[model samples]
Target: MIVAAVPRFRHIVAEVWRPLAALFVWDVAVTIVYYRLPFHAPELPLTLFGTALALFLGFRSNSAYQRWWEGRTLWGAMINASRSLARAARNFLPEPHAHDLKRTIVLRQIAYANALRCQLRRQPVDAQVLRFLSHGEAEPALARTNIANGLVDGTGRRIADAVRAGWLDTIQQTQLESVLVDIANAQGGMERLKNTPLPAQYRFFPTLFTHMFCVLLPIGLVETLGFATPLGSTVAGLMFLAVLRIGDDLVDPFANTVHDVPLSAMCRTIEIDLLQAIGDSAPEPLQPVKGVLW
Candidate 1:
C-alpha cells in the first residue's frame, strides 16, 4: 500500500521502537552482568540458534507475502471483472434504455467495489457508495452484514430485470452473468482472506524465539566484544526484529494500514473506469498522499 520511493524512518521507528528499546536495555544489562560475574553464554549455541531462527523467519515472511500477493491478485481480478461487465453492458443491451441501464449497472459496480473495500477495512460506507445508491437502496444494503454480497445480488437482480424487459437477450444475459460470477468469486476469495489469518501458533513461535534470542545476544557476545557487546547485540537484534515486523505487517493485507492492500485506491480505480465507460465525467483517480495509497 505504501507508494513511497523510500520508507519513512520515523514510521518504522514508531512501530518497532518499543521492542528495540527493550532489547537495548536487556543487552546492556546482560553485558554488565557478564563483566561483573565472569559468566558468558556460549557463542556456539547462539550461532546455531540464530541460524535456525533465520530459517524460520524466512518461512514466516514467505507465508505472509503469499497472503499479501493473493489479496492483490483478487483485487486485480475485481478490476478486470468490472471492466468486462461495463463492456458487456455497452455492447449487449438494446437501445432506448441501454444508456440508462448501462449507467445504472456501472454505478452499481462502483458501489460493489466500494462496499467490498469498506467491508474489508471495517470502515463504514463512504460518500462514494452513498452517491451511487438511492436512499432506499443504500439503507437496505448498508443494513446488511455482508454489504458487498448484497450489492452483488442487487446486480444480479438488475441483470434479471434487463433480461425480462428485453434490454438484454438470453445470450447477452449469460455473458454478463458470467462476468458477475467472476466478480463474485473474487469477492468470496477476498472475504475468505479477510476472515481467516495465519495460524496463531505459526505467529507465536517465531516472535518468541526472536525476542528470546535478542535478549540473550549480548550475553553470548560479551566475552569477545567486551564494551562493544551492547552496540553489536542491539544492532543484530534490530535486524532480526525488522524481519519479524515485516512479516507481521504483511500478514493482514486488508487491515487498512499503510502496509495493507490499498483497497481504497483500488476501489477508486473501479469507480473511475466504470464512470468513464458510461460516458460520465469520471472522478480523478486517487493519488498517494505522503507516499501511502491508503
Candidate 2:
C-alpha cells in the first residue's frame, strides 16, 4: 500500500489522465461548436445534476474503502493468530523429546502464512512457501486445491499426534487448535472479500452518470462562460472524474497494485516472528520501495 505522506504527482496523474484528456478534448469541441456553428447552447440544470452526481460518487467511494479496510483488518487478525500458533507449538510441546516436531510445526505456520498470501493474490507457490516445507510435506499440500488450508490441517494433525505421544495433554491440544481455527476464519474472511465484488448497479451506474455529466458540462456553460468555456468546464469535470477513479482504485484490495493491501510485507512479518521464535535466523523486515509497501 502507499505509505507516503504525500503520493507522487505522476501516480495521481496516471490514474486519471485518460479521462482528463477526453474531458479536455470534449470541452474544446463544445466551445468551438458554440462559437463557430449555428448551434444554440441548451440551458441545463447543471447545479442540480452535479449535486446528484457527487452523491453517487460519494457512496461508491465509501463502499470501496470499506472493502479495502476489511481486507487489511483480516490480515491483521491472521498476523496475530500466526504468532499465537508459533508460541503454542514451542511452549506446549515437550522440549528435547519433541524438539524437531516443535520446530516443524512452527516452520509450517510460517509457510501457511505465505501460502495464504500467494493464494489471495492468485500467485504460484514460490520459494518463500516451499523453503519452509519438507519434500514429503510440500508434495501433498501442493496437490490440494487450497494449499494454505491443507497446511493448517497438517498442523492440527501434528498437534493431535503430540497428544497421542504424551508430549501434550488434551487441554493443550485444544488451546493450540483454537489458534488454528482463528487463522482459518481470518483466511475465510479475506477470501470472501476477494471473491465477492461490489454489486453491478454500484459499479456501473455511477460511472455512466459521471461521464454523462462531463459530456453535458461544456454545453451547459458555453453561453455563460463564453470564450472561457473550455477552462471552466474541464476543471469542473475533473473533480467528478477524480472521485470516480478513487472507487475503482480501492475496489479490489488483492489486485496486487500499489493501492492493494501489503500482503507480501505482512507475510514477511509472520515469517520473521515465527522463525525467531523457534531459534532460527530470520530475514530482515520488508521495507517500502518507492513509498509503496507492496
Candidate 3:
C-alpha cells in the first residue's frame, strides 16, 4: 500500500491512467464533432446529471469507508482481546509451568493473527508466522485449510490442559474462555468482511454513472469552451473518476492494496504487545515503508 507522506500525482496517474486516457479520447472526439458536424447537445441536462452522479458517488464512497472502518475496528478489538487472554493466563495459572504455557498460548495468538492476515490476503503463511508456532504445531497449522482456525483449536486445547492440570480453577478457566470467545468473534467479523463484498449493483451503478458523466462532459462543454473543451473535460472527468476509484479501493479492506487496512502491520503490533507481556524482547513495531503501515 502507498505510504507516502504527501500524495504523489504520478502515483495517482499511474493507477487510473487507462480510464483517464479513455476520457481524454472521448473528450477529443466530442470536441471534433462540435466543430465539424454543426451539432451541439444541450448543456442543461448535463448539469443535472452531474449533480445526481455526485450524490451517487458520495453514497458509494460512504458505504465503502464504512467497510474499511469496520475492518479496522475489528482488528483493534482483536489486539485488546489477545492482551486480555495473556494477562488472564499469567495471573490465573499456577507457577513455573504458567510462564511456559502462557508464552506458548501467547505465541499461538501471534500465529493466529498472522494466519488470519495471510488467509484474508490469500497469501502463503510467512516465516514470521512459523517462528511463533512450536515445531509440532507449525507443520499441522500450515497443512490445515484454515490455518487460523487450526491455531485457535490448539489454543483451546492448551486452555483445556491448563484446567485439567489444576493450574487454573474453573472460574479462571471461564475468564480465559471468555477472552477466547471475544477473539473468535473478532475473527468471524474479519472473515465476514473478507468473504462478503458490497452488493454488485452498488459497485456497478456508480461506476457506470461516473463513466457516463465523463463521456457527456465534453459534449456539454464543447459549445462554451470551443478549442479548450478537450483540456477542460479531461480535468473535470479525472475528478469524478478519481472519487469512484477511491471508493473502489476502499470497498475491499483485506485485498492488501495500498488503501487496505494494513493487516500485516496490525498483526505485527499484536505480536509485539503479546511477546513483551511474556517478558520476551519483542521485535520493534513495523514502521510505514513509505507512509503506509502495511
Please report, in order, the local distance difference test score of every candidate based on alpha carbons: 0.87, 0.89, 0.85
* Residue 85, candidate 2: alpha-carbon lDDT: 88
Q: Which candidate ranks first by TM-score, i.e. highest?
A: 2
- Which candidate comes out best when scored by lDDT? 2
Which lDDT tens digits does candidate 2 get at residues 1-294?
999999887888898889889999998998888888998888999999999999889999999999999999999999999899888888887779999998889888889888888888888875656888877877777889999898899988888888889999988988998998899899999999999999999999998999999999998999999989889988888789889988998999999999999999998999999989988999999999999999
Question: Lowest summed-lDDT stretch of 10 residues in model 1?
Answer: 35-44
List the candidate numbers ranked by lDDT, top first.
Answer: 2, 1, 3
Residue clash pairs of candidate 2: none
Over 105-151, each residue of candidate 1 has an lDDT whose tens digit, in order, gives 88888998988888888887756578787867666667778888878
lDDT of 3 by residue, 96-163 (tens): 86778888888899888888998899888757567777677677677788888878877888899988
Query: Which runs in model 2 stand beyond 4 Å of their true positions?
Result: none
- Model 1 C-alpha lDDT versus the unseen true structure: 0.87
Which order, best to worst by TM-score? 2, 1, 3
TM-score of each: 0.96, 0.97, 0.95
| lDDT for model 3 | 0.85
Clashing pairs in 3: 1-258, 3-290, 3-291, 3-292
After superposing candidate 1 on the true structure, give the runs of residues whose Cα lies further than 4 Å from its correct spot: 40-44, 126-128
